[model samples]
Target: MDDKKPLKRHEALKPLSRQHHFGLLFSWKLRKGFAGNISVNRLKAYADWFFVHEIEPHFKLEEDHIFPILGVRDALIVRALKEHRRIERLFHDQDNPKNSLSLLEEELEAHIRFEERVLFAEIQKVATQQELKKIEEIHFEIGSKEEYMDTFWEKN
Candidate 1:
């Protein structure tokens, strides 16, 4: 692993960094839900809600605004896109919620790590100031709406 710290993300990309925080929290929530033996349906409901509310838009921003900084032809871009599709499928897989949620927990963490450790670093190295400013202008902060109704993960 690189001992060097990841590059400081520009102000324009900070919104995506915020989304990464939620992505990490999603993984943590899944781990808690699994360990607590929360009902699969309950975990699935949260995953579905998050997929719609957070993940989808976050992925869109990366695809539309961030990845272009590296160009779509970049191998890192290809892998990130493929992972996004796989993660999306796992989140939507109702037939096997247990298996899907387990995979989702692991894959989501891995995807975020790749972006933070590799893809984003590469992007920041290559992105021009004007491109970053454009990203900042279009970025929208996501706000929490209704709280999760179930608190099974908090119980233990």
Candidate 2:
């Protein structure tokens, strides 16, 4: 039997975790688009949509609600915020979109992985019950449902 401890995600952060799942799906869809020789413009357009609909709000929630739990100076929070800026840049880079999309696919996946595996675990470990409750409140109020029109990731 493996003895490694399974990380327990708290109820407060569940919404963010679910968002991370969508982020991973976004990355996977981009990979599929790349593999299938889907047009870079199509992929970039979808990326832009996802950035506005999903990533921007998600980042705001984390920065405003969650990161303060760990403090801005905390190395993990600093790294996460930097990753957010980089990911945003990748999504917005229209001049060299093909390369940018490729980098976005990789970097976005890595950013999600970092949050899921490291930063969030630390946040949950240190956050007070009151803080967690507040996080849950804001998260629910934000309503994280995504409804993008194009299901470009679907196998044609």
Candidate 3:
């Protein structure tokens, strides 16, 4: 049974939430790749591409605009920032690509869930209309719908 209060996301933050949706999909793809015995190097390559095309700019927007609404010292902001750093490290790990990818798969999903379920809720609760409007004005403009060439996650 679910008891958590339902959150209504402000229109301004919808773009970031949409990116969070993609982030969750990325995690699912990693899980599928691992379960299907796809090569670690191949998965790592996809992670690298995703970091550049998606996560980097998403992080930039959050750090630049969203986090400040709650201030850096807020516990939720601290945890969110730390998760971002840890996830970035997992994506960049070269020494144990397999282990890192496995961890990344789990951690990335958890991170997105955290943002969606908790942090964003708090932000919306506290953010003023002007702050949200400023966020909406920032123009996230994430990448197009172009597909990655590798289809390892797909069943042939």
Candidate 4:
């Protein structure tokens, strides 16, 4: 009776993999806000803040630096890029926070899962040592820990 969990990800993709962890946490936090009956305005404010501080740059890095390794024509790259556009629209949707957040929650999770299970595996397969090293170098400079003044997500 083997009960072993799956093997961890490869070393080269680990940083991006770590970013996915944060992305998933963002989804969970949104879920928590909904469950806790947090205000839509409060959640929207947080979402806007996160889009600026985190999601924007994260998406850029993946598109500009990471995804190009596999070329734009690659089906996975195409799908990822499309999802990025859709997710960006959802985040910035001013007319409908309720619907936008709901869709964002589900789509964001699906996008992360696709990247982790499919896209990243393809990327790792195709990326060279030099390419991976470049990714490592670029990502090492971007730290996630700078604090923001708004603690809306924190318990009051």
Relative to the true structure, candidate 1 has a C-alpha RMSD (angstroms) of 2.1
Q: Say which prediction, candidate 3 or candidate 4, comes out ahead on TM-score.
A: 3
**Strongest candidate by lDDT:** 3
lDDT at position 4, candidate 3: 71
User: Which candidate's TM-score is highest?
Assistant: 3
lDDT of candidate 4 at residue 25, scale 0 to 100: 82
Q: Considering summed lDDT, which 10 consecutive residues are worst modelled in model 1?
A: 139-148
- What ordering of candidates by lDDT runs from best to worst? 3, 2, 1, 4
Q: Each model's C-alpha lDDT?
A: 0.86, 0.88, 0.91, 0.83
TM-score of decoy 2: 0.91
Query: Which candidate, 1 or 3, would have the higher lDDT against the true structure?
Result: 3
The global Cα lDDT (0 to 1) of model 1 is 0.86
For 9-102, candidate 4 gives per-residue lDDT tens digits of: 7676787787788779888878888877788887888788778877888898898898999999999999999999999999999999988997
What does candidate 2's lDDT look like per residue over 9-122, in tens digits? 999998788889889999999999898888887898888888878889889999988999999999999999999999999988978999999999999999999999999999
State model 4's lDDT: 0.83
Q: What is the clash count of model 4?
A: 0
Superposition error at 146 for model 1 (Å): 3.9
Off by over 4 Å in 1: 1-7, 143-145
Model 4, position 20, has a per-residue lDDT of: 81
